[model samples]
Target chain A: MDSPNNDYLIKKINYEIKKRNIKKVPFLEIRNNRLQGVVSSGSDIRRVYVCVIDNNNNTFSCHTNNNRKCGGLDTQYVCSHLSALISQANLRSEEDEKFDTLASTTNKQGDTKARYPEVFARFQHYLKYLQMEATIESIPEMEWFISN
Target chain B: MTAKITLKENDHINNPMIFSNDVKLDQVFEIQHQLIQVFSNGFSKLNSKGIETLKEINIAFSTSPLNTLISEAITGLNNNQLTSSNFDLLAIVMASIDGSAYDSLFDELNKLMENQVSLIDNAKEINYTSNTEDHENFLESIKSWLIDLAIMGFTEINMDVLESFEQVMDTLENIPELMRLNVILRGFIEEITTEIPITSQDEFPAKRWLGLWLRSYLLTMQLPKENVQSIKDCKLKIIGVQKYSHDYFTLYTFHGILDHEGNNRLIQIEAKKFTINEVSNNELLDLLNSTHPELFKGLEENLVIQVKQGMISGNYLILEKFKTTTTSFDIYETLAVLFESKTISYNKQNPYNRHPLLLKYPVLCKIENITKDGTSKFDWGDIPIRFDKVGTLNEKWKLANSKGIFGFIQFDNGWWISPVTILGDKNQYIGYTYSQDRSGKNVYEVLKERSNAILRSKS
Candidate 1:
């Protein structure tokens, strides 16, 4: 199969942002399999790029210029991007399951194998949230100092 | 770059009811609330005195781990070198007096020393006869352990978990040693007590607590009891344990309830935990002799009796030489009868069978009948696996693995066979018929199919 289309992915991301009802929708772009985006938190429009997959084999990163602080959009952008990809993959798997051969041979004991990847993604997200809770619990007056 | 801490958006972001950690005290307070809720619900109803005892549990978040607290207390005690043996104990007591009205815990120690003066005096080995002193020492030892556990930074100041380490320790300590043993021996005895699931009975309130306690207790003292409820209700469960452990002596009455009231029934007497240690074997034998001196009067009764009496003197050797006889059937049928009866004792007194000393106690059954199933009787050739289905085993292998069979196997041809089928020379699948074909595939094809299909179906 051909690689997923860049323009199509950007449009898909835009549609997801609207669907999720997230205000200040960011513009997403892709070039040669690399995902790029511009997201602003009302005060600042930061340029971000998901350039490298981390140790868990997930691509999540943000870049900054000389004068400013760390990227605001990095964490959420990564989470949202991964969530959207999962949604798309699930949709495609559902369509693929319509074929009898795909349903029988690949599907073990009448159950589809499509849910595992989504489950893994959900587990990773849960761990991330736990880490966030731990960070919040640690230190005195922990009032979003990084975002601050 | 510089490291910075931030509140995770997920915390209280989705859930409106949950408060955010923006205010530090709120987070700590919330954690404390959660811990209290968990502690109250999880542990309060265990015992009548539980609620009051739980109130005294000290919970506070500390940066140090429990082991670190213990080591630190040990070090502090060493610095003074006041008392070498129980220094660790003194340190724990001193450290845990945070909320008490004491400046220096040395005063409290002084008070304890004065109060337990008799115990301190009787600590010498010569004073071992004093039961009260021994009990005091036991309590003191337990308290020392509890205090050490408490000092181990068991909880965060915010009460991170439902129960503190000290609470867990105290709870385990509170369980009597006997109850603990019952719990530990539960799983092992569960297989033996097939009458009714013991936990299902309303009378067995201490089921969970028993299981937990016995696991800890059995590590210390390996007494034999199968399951906790058997120990609690005093059922066949204890019989199984006694059967497993040979050295320990177990004496129990069989009739459950009405036996307590005025009722005339024969009591089944058996040993549970019978262990004659190397030091006490001679002492035990002497005790048995002295206790049952009447046994000497009945020595003739203990003698083995021949059912078909025969008298042979000079003809014994000549008759043996002349009688060259061979039996058509296996001697196993007769031996199996003796085996089930347990009349075939395999101990120092008997030498024929050298069965391993796996169990210390013999499970004595009241021989009700000689032909019944799974009862206290010998059913001679009802061998778990049938020899009649020996030849077509490979074909009707399905019948071999019936639930009641002793050994079972499923073959590639939808046939399940028993280990006995290996009797057939290279063709091990000698006996068995197929189970009715499901999915239109013959039994053998399904058996040879990827192991998953067979296993999933079995499940």
Candidate 2:
């Protein structure tokens, strides 16, 4: 896909997500070569199994027994649930970069731990993953994706 | 110590008519003329014995007219038309009337004058002038008039009337003639007090007002030795002292023994022009120990001197000593105070199940479960976040949740809620459903398609 087409697809996904008011990011994880997650069609808590081709492209597919289909799952069309997931992925990458910067700057002084204990606790969790010598390839593309 | 009585504004009077600016001086003079005419009619019927004596004259025919005249005079006096002549005429007429009528009329006039002084003091624009000569002349006239009334057996009237006369004497100190008249007035009071027997129980009609008046009269005469002895003889207990101003202090006392009327009324002695020496608490204690040690015996151990400062424009202090008792409270009592003072409301139907205090101190909660129908359950970990201090928790939660695929719920108790599905749009009020059914279909996507279809159909 061309760069313009990818941008258009991302925009379409975002518009759909906003239109549907899809607030919750569905459970997503990287398994084998596929990016898999559950995404809500709208406000209904019912879930749709979405599988995306992990080629850094906008190719994805969704399946649900309830006859509800996300048109945006196709490369030609985009849905809000797909847009919300994409947006969630982008946000996770930016947050990871910020955490890396904060960690590097606050390496000497652990004073930030006292001021923001919650953030420091999560940072410590990230540090544990780093300590295990886990490379970026070992983790899911979305840094916030927690396996159920 | 020399007693210095600086008169402060009396606050007891609240009369709009007295404070009205439209009152004319001629109107006041007219009322005065009418009062004098009534008094002259009463005086004409008196023969030498009747005029010279305080005996009941057939002035019964003139009582109703005299009362009407006095009422009109009072209205004028209260409206600030009280001239020196009017005061003199009222004093003489009050002395000559029968004791019962005199007592009632004198009381009314006394109240009117008090209200007039109060109104003048309170008015922002003072139009009336203080006539020093007129006031002095009125004092002189009252002294001579009292002497004549005393010789005519009018001294035996109710003590309430004497009390009213004492109040009139209070305003006379500013007059220059008061120096000589004070001596004469002291003699009269001394003679009267001697004749009027002081008793805790008596059949006298004026016993209560007279007993109170005698104590005040002795104090005014600067006879502290006699004053103390008189208080002890009459069995009076000094309760408290209220300092209204630098020069005026009202000493409140109750009778140690009930009067003949079985009334133990609180007697207020208005001591004016009293000078207070510069003394700390210790110095005052030492002085009290030396001069009046018996005064301290009545006080409780835990006496709290509550000095209410800044009551007036200047640096004024009103010190009141009150006995205090220490009471200890347990946990239950502390809870009672909390329940009584702090308003806490609870709603059983609210999703957060929050008390008002909890909403005040909002905490971030992890979304534990989200039903397919959009309702979510949250688990707030150990950390406490004050919702009031954190501006817009919905926005902050949205920003924080952007970094994670896991959903979170942020709400201000019952005020509003940010459901997990529409995390970014915190202001959206999408209905929540807590059903556990997972339809294997994205409800958000389904709703979005339906909304788009509706929009497409409408367009």
Candidate 3:
């Protein structure tokens, strides 16, 4: 069966994490895979796969293991990630506002840009690191593991 | 000019009525009508002309107040033998010729004028020729006769009786003003019927005690039946008064069930002298249970009394007497119990989904400190203070030990930490926390006994 809708669910999960202020565990390059009609019991079962990237750019994958699939567990996982991201973003936004306000007061445009180079550089580095992380598990194995 | 009164230099006498010949009277009239229309429609629609005209009037007058003008007007009315129509037009002119200049004065004049009843020429012809040496006593007797006639005519109408214009008027001339042609035209309908002959008017006794008792009853019974019948058979007896501050009214009736059956049943109960908000849901529930034991005799465990305050946000009701011996209590089961008791009758459907049982009374219990080591617990006595800034709570807690009760609790880092007691010893502990603060985070340790047991149980 086609994978469960991830794009919409991911945004919602990210939003809740940010809202709840939940601390993030160490992980990277998260992916949510929705597997429908995967069970062999003449009946259908849906599954969601969670994957994240580490500092070494390695992908770590997990799935909801309970017999009764709970939307709350999926929500909890995404919420934790979003919460960490939100806390970091809040701190960064405050610093950015401060920097921009300070920079606007400066007479030279180049000097102002130079003053916030480290912040811009670190943001770029994190973006590249996130993009470089790879998903190692195959679709067949993911489906097999999700059903089991 | 018919007459010109010369004024001394630096005289600040203000005449509110000053006219200019240069301005067209018709245009001024139109603008004045528009201004009145704007005011009638609401205060929001005041055009530039309206505002300017109002400002001009305010600037011209309001120096030597309108009380003197009113007194002069009263004298003029008596001397000129002016008709009620003329007096009414004059009053309207005084009110509207300027913007709010004579408003307060008019109000005072109206109040003074309402007390006196202006009788018709037929009633005025009854002249007593030196009937008694005491003139005041004679006039009072005449007034009493007039009052009885007025009340007899008024009781015909089924509408709730408020004080009438005649009852308010205190003067002989003012009494006649009530039946003025212009006054009637101004929507002041005759409160009493015209079938009764023009006897003397009667004065209404200011029923302050009755009004207070009714207000107190209404407040105590938050949501009474839709139709609160005029207290026909009701007799209010005062039980006791505490230093003239708290006066209690005890109403006794035969039928005690408070329901929406609309079966005109006589109900009676003893209620304490308290504000409407002070009537706790638990008390109402207890009364209900006691009166109708069949509804909840053996079903007490399943029944819950939910009292919500304000209904929008999360506020909790504490089953006051149900505090546990130890620390834990089943909050979920308590909530379930409360919700189950809310049986919605087909007739009593609430439009706001406000099930009567969902109403929650606020719980304001504090865990008191009894010892220095903070290990002892006791009943809270004083009002607890709330602190917002960091370090304020810690500092205040340290200062206000066993010496005295200081109302203080500090909120910081998504928690309200208060100095509370456990086993008769006082200690600092977390009082409350938001769910948003704990989502995806490890559960923070809280003192089991110190927390709002309901919240802890639910968690």
- Candidate 2 Cα outliers beyond 4 Å, as residue runs: A1-148, B1-83, B90-241, B248-273, B276-289, B301-459
Q: Which predicted model would earn the best TM-score?
A: 2
The DockQ values of the predictions, listed in order, are 0.01, 0.00, 0.00
Candidate number of the best DockQ: 1
Best by lDDT: 2
Model 1, DockQ value? Answer: 0.01
- The TM-score ranking, best first, is 2, 1, 3
**For each of the candidates, what fraction of the native contacts does it recover?**
0.00, 0.00, 0.00
Q: Candidate 2, residues A27-143: lDDT per residue as tens digits? A: 333322223344544544333434332332324544432333444444444455545555555444443342222212111211111112222222222222111211111100111
Off by over 4 Å in 3: A1-148, B1-291, B294-361, B368-459
Scored by Cα lDDT, where does model 1 land?
0.23
Between prediction 1 and prediction 2, the one with superior lDDT is 2
Tens-digit lDDT track of model 3 for B105-130: 22332243231211111111222222
Q: Each prediction's TM-score against the native?
A: 0.17, 0.18, 0.14
User: What TM-score does model 3 achieve against the real structure?
Assistant: 0.14
Span of ten consecutive residues with least summed lDDT in model 1 chain B:
B235-244
lDDT of 2 at B9: 21
